[model samples]
Target: MKRTTSSKRCNYVLEKLKLHYSGTSYCNCFEPPWLCPEVEECVWKPESNKSKQFTNAVNTWIDLSKKTNNLFIKKQLYEWLDMNHANILAVDRGLYPVERFFPLEKKGIFNTFLGRIIMEILPPCKNTKGKNKILHLLSKACPKRCQIRNLKEIVLQYATEDDQTYLFLLEVMKKSLLGKYNHCKVQLQFEGRHVFYQMFSYQISQKSFFLKWFENGNHQIFLFFCLKEYLCDAVRQVKTVYDYIEKHWKWSIFDKQVVKSMDNCRKILNTISEREYNLLHVSDWISSIESFLLQVSKQHIKLFRTTNAMGYISKLKVNLNKYIISEDLNVDIRQDVSRFLWEITQRTTDKNVFYYALEVLGLEREVVEKVKNEIFCALDYKMLSPNDLFTLKEFCRVIELHKSTYNFVLPKHYYDKQVLSLKKRENKNNQAIGYICFICNDIKFFLTKLSDSSRHSNKLARGSLRVVVDNDISCCHENNLKFVCGKKPERHVKNSKKKWKNDKKALTRKLLKEKQRNFLSKQCIQTPLQEIDLLGHAIQFNNKMIMLCSSCGNVCMLDPESFKYSVNINCKVCHVSPRDICIKCNTETTCNKILVYNQRRTKFHKAPMCNNCTNVYAQKQPVVI
Candidate 1:
């Protein structure tokens, strides 16, 4: 402040410029505080320290490593520095004081991040010696969590058919991830489906690397067979999707894609001859066959051998003795039938919608129930029994035989095939099409062929030549279609005749009602006394003065033909019928009996009582309605 030096003045001017025009002077070309984008960082370069650009980058990385607590950031910094002996020597020779602080094998990065990075930098396919050197470092690495993209890359590019090196490499890769999991133990992706399981899973994916491993792996020569195991898994998946569609006739988009992928994989598999496929699965087949042969040789069957069971065993042996019999065919057929029977058994046990909806056409309810119980009992016994004839696949075969012999009918749903009503037709006429529903009386006029089909009766509108006549009927339903235009059936004609008769009866009733009104009006003026008495009765009698004849102190109408005759006190022959027994006196009486005390109509419930109980009840206090 007393006397400014040149350096202080220059600093003052620079600070003022930075504060006022800082944003204007800045550009994207300026180097970032961390790694420089323009510089090509390499570990092999010895003169990296001598170059100003490289030194600046190294300094920035060192600063970043010191300041950041994040492990991933530190990893990125170390990777930026290109951690290698040559880079280490260059940094040391350059006289960088921070070289000693660099994270090494002892710093926990060795077995984890450093090992993974080293493996990536020196893949076994490219640098086998370097990869081997650091292979020991990966012993502590987490197999399930750690990344191994380089190993997969090695398998894809460098793996050769029957190469010991490739085999050893595959073993190492398999050991890293699939520890203790043998070929049989490795679960298929189809089973145990989970969302997170797909994300981190490095092994057994649809990628080409694993596919190549399967294609190249020699199962016959190696006891640790990789190809045969995963190949079987893929084949099983293909078979499962195919069977559901082929046997059950179920189809879905996802299943279609799965079938396509499996077909592609099968094409790759065909490269290895069918003999190899047999050799791959032969061990399991031989063991099963040996067990069956031993059982037959020892005469294992005793009292359990019924005629049907013996015949089943003979047929099984015949099938097994065929020259073309293979493990895949037998195993697949058995599994398919077992699964189908198991599902059917489960449905029957649960009494699902389909089971409850089952109807027998010509059987009494009792007979149907008994037959159903017997069938279910047999199915339960078959499931529990060890007899060969009752085995799921064998039982299914027996059922098939019986079906051909007896013409056994199955549920309609089981045999029904869903056929599309509106089969899409090509526009050969090159004109717009109109879809019209005569049943619903709906017309989608001048619609393009590409337009979605209109739904009617849960079916799309199909192409058919229909001559529909429009009438006044407003209901958008199929039942009215014949009334509008279509040829009438016998039932429709009968219904029309019945409707005409009903209309005639209704007209006659209307005329009788009008005649009754005119007679009442004329009688009202002619007979004044009757009119006054009737008007008083009509006004006072809210409940039509209807009462049971049994409980009345006076004689009531004996038979009433109509409500008008029953309500008339003068009518002696018309009365409500006495059908109920007396509640108080155990005697026959009318159910609607209401006792009257004095001239006043007492408000009380219709408690059925005999004349003797009514007289006693009249002496006691009357109950209000």
Candidate 2:
């Protein structure tokens, strides 16, 4: 979660890629760095569109140069652009650089349109059309610097068919399909001329990942993600000389020289701060602080060097009590103040202190100036981990110590976006007010409905209130907050508690008494109930005649003409002929069959089978199921 300096991270990439050893990690002819991961991940994504265009532009020039002459370049078309250009960028900015590949000696012919295309647009190359089979171009030069030679004999120093740099350039181009930075600054030796690209690739997971990272990841990109872990541990120390002057020397309030010089120093601090900050005054303010510190050093030369001079240690605290700054000074300006304070404390009596500081800062300015000008040179600003309170304290501490190198000038706001997406409200009361639940997006209280609605979002419920800023759902409360929620304001019920009184109440009681009497009368009559008994009947098989048998009343299967009467009647339930027993017991039923039960069989059981027979059959047959 901590961030380190951009320099340290860049160095890590260099070591990790093995490019610091100076031999190529790419070329298979040499041993390479460790292979990259299969997955793609980088501190900064490489898909800068300007970079892709630069890549494509290089290939276009290569194609143009390769074909400029099956014949000599002087006779080919140059003034007339080939209608078949493969570059997506058709503007003059893209074409001008590639056109520079032509010979400068023929500046006279370039005046004519056709002559320009033939001699100036196309590289002045000679096609030997022999075993050499190579394209050669004349290097363009100023008249004062070069010895004259025939156009065909002039040669580019590095451009050659056999140059190994082209192989590296081609492989890098193929990997450009993934992503690249806006300023890759690639150079390749072409067959006819040198090609310079404004951008290049730095994808760390490609086959040539190490080459790209080592070449441009630090110079072109300054992403901080990679340094977060490192920065977490880089402890910040801010040294100040004022503590040494006051506590260690124990200078009294009556010291005339110290008091008078301190007042002049305070005035100078106020003078520089009265005006706005500009980096141009950086050297001027450093000179002033050095002049003042030199005077103090003259008085305490031995003491100053001997003891690192009463250096006091303090941890970063969030609660700074004195100053609250307005937003105008900005975060970046505050960081510059902290940086200036730290450097001022480092004994700037030697001229090299200011000189070396500016030199180092100038180099940093060159690095990040492309994105946001580091003209202010806000180095080590992150060390103090500034907050509003901390920044204001540092500002005062710098002023108090006569330590501002800026005088009043501040550093550049390199990364401040200052996004202003919202309209500012002029008045608190006039500001368009809304009274709504963020979860429900509703202005009114619907207790039951709110209980039913989903708490996560407002759109899912039917009865949920839709809060609209312009709508006035109800009168404002005593506190002027819109808390009222009445569906129909005119007829809305207010909670009321009172005893009920009406003539209808007496009539309602009388109606209830009559209904109770009818209910009691019905209940008494319904108490006496009846029960019915079921018995088996005899069935004659001869004529399909069915009759109830007087003997035991069991259904019997008999021929009607056997004796012109039913005989040998037996009930399946009772299992007795001309007899009755209790069916529940699996015995004969006597007087009357009570709690008559019907026997139902499984589909596997036979029609005439009893419980005992069915069980015996199931065991013997070995049921399929």
Q: Pick the candidate with the highest lDDT.
A: 1
lDDT of 1 at 266: 29
Q: Runs in model 1 with CA error above 4 Å? A: 1-49, 70-625
Question: What lDDT score is found at residue 268 in candidate 1?
Answer: 28
Provide the TM-score for each candidate, comma-separated.
0.18, 0.12
**Candidate 1 residue lDDT tens string, 349-405:** 353322223222122344235334533333233232232222322333323332222
- Number of the top-ranking candidate, with TM-score as the measure: 1
Ten residues in sequence with the least summed lDDT for candidate 1: 528-537
List candidate 2 segments past 4 Å from native: 1-180, 186-460, 464-625
